[model samples]
Structure formats: C-alpha cells, structure tokens
Target chain A: MELREMSRLLYQIKLADQRVATSFERETGFSLTRYEMLMIVNDKGVCSQSEIQQEMKIDNAAITRHLKILEEKGHVQRERNVANNREVFVRLTETAARELQHCEQNHDQTNHLIAKVLSESEMQQLSALLQKLNTI
Target chain B: MELREMSRLLYQIKLADQRVATSFERETGFSLTRYEMLMIVNDKGVCSQSEIQQEMKIDNAAITRHLKILEEKGHVQRERNVANNREVFVRLTETAARELQHCEQNHDQTNHLIAKVLSESEMQQLSALLQKLNTI
Candidate 1:
C-alpha cells in the first residue's frame, strides 16, 4: 500500500527476473527468450506464429523477430504454410529439444531456491494469488 | 508442480513485466530501470553506488552506468565523497522529485490492474511471500 512497500515489491520482482535469466543462461547457455519460445513450441507440438502471439499475448512483430532469432540459433524451425503463404509454422529443433530437457533438470534447482522458505501451503497460496493477479 | 504450471507462471511474470514497462514508458516517458533508480535515489536522500547496489541487489558497474545516464537525464546528481574520493553519493534532482510524484499518481492505476483480482488478504499474502523470496 505504501510507496516503500511498493518499491520493495518491484525490487523483488526485478531480482527474481534477473535470477531466472542468469540461472537459465548459466545452466543451458541460452537466453530466457529462446528457452521460452522453444518450450512453447514444444508444448504446442507445432504451431503457427499467430497462435504463439495469441498464446503469449505478445505482438506479432515481436514474435516474428524472436522466431527469426530462434531459427538462426537452430532452436526452432519456422516453415511457410503451403495453404496460407502468409502463415509460418514453428516447432523445436532436435538441439532445442535436448536443451529443453536440460532446462527441466535445472528448473527444479531454481524452483527450490525460489520456494525455499515457503511451505507447500504457502506456495500454493502464492501460486493461486499470482494466477488471480495474472488474469486480465 | 507440473511443467505446464511452471510455464504458465513464467509466462504470467513476463506479461506483468511487459505491462509495467509499457505503462511506465507510456505514462512517464521513462524506462522502468530509470524510474526505479530515480525512486531509489529519492528514497535514500544521498546514497552511494555500493548502497544502491546492496539495496537493489544489482552489480556496482551496472549501477554506475545507470547513474551516469540518470545524471545526463537530470534526474540525479552524483558527487565524489570529500573524504573518500572513490565513494560517490547520489541524490535526486528537483526534476526527478516531480517525476517521482507523477510516478506515484500513475502507480495506483498500474497497481490496480496488477492486483485487480486479489483481495486485500491475498495481496498481503503475496507481498509476504515475495519478501521471503527476495531474501535470496
């Protein structure tokens, strides 16, 4: 409620973000953006760019740029849709799949550090609260 | 927790970050990092780079670079310590004070969006959880 409390909240959010970015990079030698995009592609099996944009609530242009980078990194493959020339389909590459597996192995360690102080119930409460906060 | 839940959590965190960044830039024409550093300097009265680094959990070099930009932007002023030349003290300029005041006013609207679904208790719980998480 107070400005000081709000400042602390914002600072913690920043710290958590840095921690995640650093951890992901240190463990997998890839940026968080690359990891996230690969995970999304892996989850969807194969998805169009528009689907990724919609699901991520990101702009189409940003998605396009990131996909291009991911493609160059060999983390994902983007193919022109034959039926719809404008559409591009994306899926994870074999190398990306291996990196994602490594990511999962490292994720547990990071998650444990994040939730070290909170009990199971507290973490559940926190997660539920965050989910509520996340709803637009 | 499942990978799906973890992915969703990370996604929401990213969305929250994007929302804050967009809102701050739109409302104040300043980036989040700039705003945060300004706010920190304002809070500290006269803070050293080491102090800022400690408080924000950021590296000293990054703090120095941001402070240089903030100095150029006229949001803060830095002076070498009279007794210890290596130490630099930073404080907000009058312009920054005005901007911070504007930030507080705009902050409510952004905060409302972020916590729209959270009850007061939930917000408190979330804050407490985050505080604990920040210790690491």
Candidate 2:
C-alpha cells in the first residue's frame, strides 16, 4: 500500500474507534478505559492494582488516577493487602456491579449502532484484517 | 453480528490503532496527536488556536495544552491576535519543519511495518469498512 493510503487507513481506524468509545461513554457514563478497569475488577472479584495495570497495559499513575475516581464515585473499594504493605487490592462495590449490567447493555447498543453499517460478511472481513494488523 | 463479536472487533481496532500510534511516537519522538497539530500549523502557515481545535475535533483545553508543550519545545510559536485579544495564532518554527521531515520518514516506516501484515486488497477492504463505520 502507498504510504499516504496506509496513513489514512490508520487515522480512519483511530477515528472510528474513538467514535465508538465516545458513544459508549455518552450512553453509559463511563469512559471506555474506566469501564474496562471495572470489568477486570468485577471479573476477578478482587485484584491488585498492579494486576489491573498489567491487564490494561497502562502505567501506575494512570491506574491510580482511574481507581481514585472510581473510589470517589463509590464504584470501587481499595484496601491495603494484609501480607504485603505495598500491595493494594481493588474490588467493585455493590453499586458498581449493579450499574455495570446496565452499562453492558449500553455498550452492546453502541457497538450495534456502529457495526450495523456493514454487512455481516464485511464485518467478518474487517475483523480478520484487524486481527492480522494487531499481530504486531 | 453477535454483540460479543462486535465488541471484540471494536477492541481489536482500538488495539491496532494504539499499536501504530505507540510505534510512531517511539520512533519519531512525537505523539501522533502532537504531530498532527504541527502538521496543521505547517499547512496553514499561521492559523488561530480555535482552527487547530476545530480541525482536530479536540477541545480548547487540550489544544492549549498541546500548544504550550509545542511552544516550550520550540516546535511551534503562538501569538495573541492583534485584532482579537481572545484569539491566538499558531505557526511551526523552522526547527519543527526540519525535524518534521525526519519524523515523516519515521512515520512512513512505522506505518509500513504495521501495514505490511495485510495484503493490498485487505487494506483497501479495511479502509472501506472503517469509512463506513465512521459515518456517524
């Protein structure tokens, strides 16, 4: 592919991804990163801050900031690990789990709205191409 | 498409876009957003801050922050408009334009590395699908 065409395609992919994320946030009141962090906590029942950082591929400061906001919003609770003073464990609050169910529905709706533009076959092709590109 | 499948595809697209952006930054010493902002300033010779924000679809605070960093780095110059105190004009410095030439080469190499994974037809198809998805 020509360099210009490749650059344009990359920008389009970024823009489309942002579109979905913005729509998801508008409908669910959670940024995509925050929602994914919540999912990690909900999935593990409880996990350490480092584990969340590893799972999300984010740095320490970013994870700490997101968790702080989640804690302030009463969506998560964090406590020091008993055996490890340096370790911090995080878990979703009851309010968070309940709200997550509603957010999941909104996430699905947002995905549907974006994905509906292409046919099933086109989506399959796009997914396959994306998977190939993501191999890096 | 199943919601799960759609979600996975969206995630893949996000991941791939990030991969390209991270690689470009690592190779060029400029974040993709910052590079784009510089490109806008270079293309316009001199334009208002609001024009950059509008062209980028970013908010005022973000554009201001990026421009501040660019100014500190000697990559761009920002001056208050003489006729309108509220408006600010931005232009790339000679150093920025020179460095941008090198950065552009690195950017092409980065894009080439990522795009080499897909065949030409696959890229075209992916580009078309992304255009459709971005219609919203």
Candidate 3:
C-alpha cells in the first residue's frame, strides 16, 4: 500500500473508533474502555489483572487507569484474594450485568451498520487478515 | 456477521489505532490530534478556523482545542489575514516544518505493518469497501 492509502486506512479506523465510543456513551453512559472491561470480565467469568492485561495487550498503566474508571463508575469491584495477597480479582457488578444486557439488546443497530458496510465474506477476509497480523 | 464479529472487528481497529498513536507520540512528542492538525494546515496551504473544521470534518470546538494545544506548543501560529477582518490564517512554525519533514523521512512503521499484513488485493478491496461505508 502507498503512504496515502495507509493514511486513509488509519483515518477510517479512527472514524470507526469514534462511532463506537459515541455509541457506547449514548447507549449506556459507559466509555468504550468501561464496556470493554465489562465484556472481558464477563467472558472470563473470573479473571485477574494479568489475564486482563494479556487479553487486551495494553500497558499495565493503561489497565490500571481504566480499572480505576470502572471502579469509580461502579461497574466493577476488586476483591483482594486472601490466598494471594497481591492478586486482585476483578469482578463485574450486578449493575454491569444489567448494562451489558441492555447493550446486547441494542447491539443489533450497531451490528447492522457494520454488516451493511462490509459484506459477510469481506468481514471474514478482514478478520483472517487481522488475526494473521496479530500472530506475526 | 454476528454482533460478536463486529465487536471483534472494532477491537482490532482499536488495537491498530493504539499502535499508531503510541508511535506518533514517541516520534514527535505530539498527540495524534496535534500532528493531524498540523498536516491539515500545511496541506490546505492556507488555514483558518472555519477551513480546518470543514476539511477535517470535526466540530468547531474540537478544532479550537487542538489549535490551542498546537499554539501553546509553539508549532503553529495564527494572525489576522488583514484581507478578512474576522478571519485568521494559521501557519506552521519552522519547528513544525522540520518535524513534518522528519516524520515523512521516517516512514511510519505502521505503514509497513499494514502492507505486510494485508495482501495487495486485500488492501485495494478494503479501501474501496471503506469508501463505500464512509458514503453512508
């Protein structure tokens, strides 16, 4: 790809991000980071900081900051593991579960936008390409 | 595609963005917004608040904040155009010109990453697909 194409691709990615961030705030009063943390915690059932860090592949400092945001938002609670004093297990609050449910129910519109933008085959192609990139 | 697939796609986009943002920050000690604003001003060859807003497709408030940051950083300057009493033209400082030259000389690694990750056909197809999406 030429430099111009690279710039446009990056710009498109930014626009997509803005769409999601705006959608989350308008739909659930949650920031994208808060929604992501909730989703990950829910997916894992129960997880620690290390697992979250690995799954997100973000810096620990960024994780710490987002966790603080989540805590302040009352979407998550941290429990100190008695067996491992230094380990903090992150668990979603019931409030988060309710919000996630709402998000899921409202997600159809968002998904429709994406699917309408890219065909099923194209999305699969994009995913395959991205996953390959991730591994490398 | 399912909602899950769309979410994953969006997440991948965020990962790409995070990588780009981190690299841009490290290279120029400037935020993505700052760098982008500088690029726009230079490309326009004549810049004003109204022009920046129209070209960048951002709200006036956002442009104001970014220009303020750029101004404070001493990378940009604005003065009344004299021809238009109510309008001001923004100009890049010598420092900004030098930095842009440096950024151009050091091609963004993210560019190479994109090219390496996507097949040539895939890149062209994705760009066309994204352009269609932007229209909607």
lDDT of 1 by residue, A6-87 (tens): 5455455566656655654665566666566677789899999989887777788889999998888788888889999898
Q: Write the per-residue lDDT of candidate 3 for residues B1-136, one digit (tens) a residue.
A: 5444556666775676677566546655666666677887878776789998876666889988888878898888988889987887898998888887787667655456565567777767666655655543
How well docked is model 2, in DockQ terms? 0.43
TM-score for all predictions?
0.80, 0.73, 0.78
Q: Which run of 10 residues does model 1 chain B get worst, by summed lDDT? A: B1-10
DockQ of 3: 0.35
Model 3 lDDT, full chain set: 0.71
Model 2 residue B78 CA deviation in Å:
4.9
DockQ of each: 0.40, 0.43, 0.35
Please, what is the whole-model Cα lDDT of each candidate in the order they appear? 0.70, 0.78, 0.71
Work out candidate 1's RMSD over C-alphas.
3.4
For each candidate, give the interface RMSD after superposing the true interface residues on Cα: 3.3, 2.7, 3.3
Which pairs clash inside model 3? none
Better of 1 and 3 by DockQ: 1
User: What's the C-alpha lDDT at position A30 in model 3?
Assistant: 63
| Candidate 2: pairs in clash | none
- Model 1 lDDT vs. the true structure? 0.70
